[model samples]
Target: MNLPPVNIENIDIKLRFGNFVLNVLYVKFGYFLSSMPEHSHSQGSYELHYIPQGKGTLIAQDQSYPITPGTLFMTGPDIIHEQIPDFNDPMAEYCIFFEVLPGDSTPAINRNHIANDRLMSELLMSTPFWIGTDRENMMALFEMLASELSIQSVGFHHTVTNILEIIVIRLVRQYSLHTSSLHPVPLKTLDDSRLLTIENCFLYQYPSITLKKLADNLRLSTRQTERAVRKQYGISFSEKKAQVRMSAASRLLLSTELSIYAIAVQIGYTSQEQFSNAFKRYYGMTATQYKFKRI
Candidate 1:
């Protein structure tokens, strides 16, 4: 699909630990049928490339990496890179160019938070080049961005900004996984975005997720984590977790033919009996009854 290029001059993007202002130079989506000449970004600039289909080769500073469907890579400041698509199966790509800038002001609540952001920024800046496959399944996000830009519906700009921010965060996460030394430190304050990330853990990682795991992910103490969840969601952590799991379970029951035991396991319940009891308490109907009633 043809997507109009998006140019964002200056916008603040919230990261896991802190925020950064960025200029999104452009976003492009197309099947690269022609080779791109070797180019390097200016200082503080990065170009992210995602290939959703076909094959290509990326040559970065004399090193070549095979690019296939689901390939993702980034060329940062001063990294020479060239793209050559295979003629037999030209690669479709989603490319984003942006320059990261320092935030206007850093909060004074915790020096550690600032340090964490700095550490992440430094990591990104120091790594001039990286090539890897997409682990976050960002094709859907790129498609959504393209759709929003093409349609230009009400609030499209806001939606586009949010999607771009998420793309940046997921990119950072990919880098963090490779750099074992990088770690999240406890923050003195939790912002709404960070709180939402914490809440989404229950949605995405409900199975085998724990309070300690959530606390560690936030780099906060368990008590502080619980307080944050309650403060933002107006409910206890367990209640919120149940709400997410039950909602998911209900969908599974209605949408799929999975057995109750399987659905219970999928949603982190130890047994069908336990899941049934919880579902009944939450929805006033047994698992089977709910399924049949909906049917």
Candidate 2:
């Protein structure tokens, strides 16, 4: 019997941002047969599979679930799983592999007193094994990844890393919303009314995101929005945003070979000198210093 290849080195990327680093192993959109044998992913790795168009049964941890379009499954660490594609029918899907460490934002995690501190820390560790997603949103993200991977163009990996972060945010949002309906108080802590939604928008559009855009989305005055951020996070909106950008910059410095100038442009800084100053203020070291030290 022919077995699917598991060459992780070819596609794997050491993706990093903030306090998070993801070892993205592989992604494929194709047919996978199950006649071979059951297998578990390596320790410290994760596998996310999305069935965009298919009929199959996913057997994991001795439980079986039917797979259909928009079905997304997540497995972290060592968990036995195997896919059984329908014998006679075509099974098409997208599978992603990666490993995340301490899946929390940089300083937010350091501030353990914050409301969502536990929530963000537990995001990847506590992900559900399988989930049903909004078909359109899920498929759009998968397709975008597929398109980028197919092209392997300039900055494709960067694009993929950004989209992967967005995907994680969406998953967390859905999970939190669902859990909130069952238990309201935790959601209230993680989200201050509609403010969490706004925060997620910032995460999705960071670096280039503008306060005016967030205010427009919420139909709130800029001052009102700023007030909400301070109320929720205990910091001004600009400070929080700079933290996010610097987090991204630091990750780029350590993980990628990009120059300080390129990293600055990617994170919305206009000049390398300006970005370098911010880096020093946030990290207490020059970007070049950080990069070489990490090396």
Candidate 3:
């Protein structure tokens, strides 16, 4: 995969590729003045964010969500989102952007339009589409991310990459199990094989996703899916998804240096308050409190 043209604009977005056949890039995770305005890159590259401290909101097109400590977000390329701070305390987060190319015999993930930009949308498909996190673990992950970012050692790329995979699988299992409250769809409807297929695609990128394209891909109604998932799992779908998303986010926060706002956008939230409200509802303490307690 072609990395964005090298420039100071992305100097911190460490890119590691070439003879290693690697395409991994990461953003700083903590303590810096956010110099860039709220805009987005048009390049189609997969991205993930982990928030460890402070408060911020993510703005995307017409949507907004919060980015608080212990929040982890992952989305495909062309997702136009920007970070918004809470204006209270220092902001901290860590993020990674990567591309997965197809391999032998396995149908290759589409690369023809990998660069097309539209902005990642969590609203395309129906309920149980796979996305979620928890509150307590989310905070723990956030602290871990901050520590890792502070070290910033050589070959950190390898370490970061491995961590990223673990985050991905945690996310996959969470969402695959309908553990996200941000996705709108309830967790009650995730039992069918179809829901699993959709989430697998989102995580593994097994099938190419069209830009802002989600229609007729699901076989359940919002109510039906929610009901079914709850019946099967014995918990509301939204709660489960949020629990999962929050947990993954915590992991990211504990491991990266990306700012809080960036991490908010990487997750599905559009602003900081939104993220905070959701987080507090789940964890009781504020993002700031969680950060301090961890230290």
RMSD of each: 18.7, 18.2, 17.9
Better of 1 and 2 by lDDT: 1
lDDT of 3 by residue, 1-295 (tens): 1112111112232222211111344444444245223322212234556666677766554366666666666554234355656665545655554433222232324543222111111221211122234432555543444445556588654665555444544543344332222222222223224433333333333123321221234455666655543543345546545644565345446546656666566666778777778767777887666655667
Sort the candidates on TM-score, descending order: 1, 2, 3
Question: Which candidate number has the best TM-score?
Answer: 1
| Better candidate by lDDT, 1 or 3 | 1
How high is each candidate's TM-score? 0.54, 0.50, 0.39
| Model 1 ranges with Cα > 4 A deviation | 1-19, 108-116, 176-295
Q: Give the best candidate by lDDT.
A: 1
Local lDDT at 194 for model 1: 53
Better of 2 and 3 by TM-score: 2
Q: Which ranges of candidate 3 are over 4 A from the true structure? A: 1-22, 32-36, 105-159, 176-295
lDDT of 2 by residue, 1-295 (tens): 2223222234546554444556565676776553313444333446777777758887776677887767777765445555778876646777776655543455644455454545643565555354665433877887787787777699997897787767765655555322211111111121222543454554556777777887887778889878766554446778777866875676567657898899999989999999999889988988888889845
Question: Which lDDT values do the candidates have, in the order given?
Answer: 0.71, 0.63, 0.44
Which residue ranges in model 2 land beyond 4 Å of their true spot?
1-18, 33-36, 102-118, 134-136, 176-295
Q: What is the lDDT of residue 5 in candidate 2?
A: 29
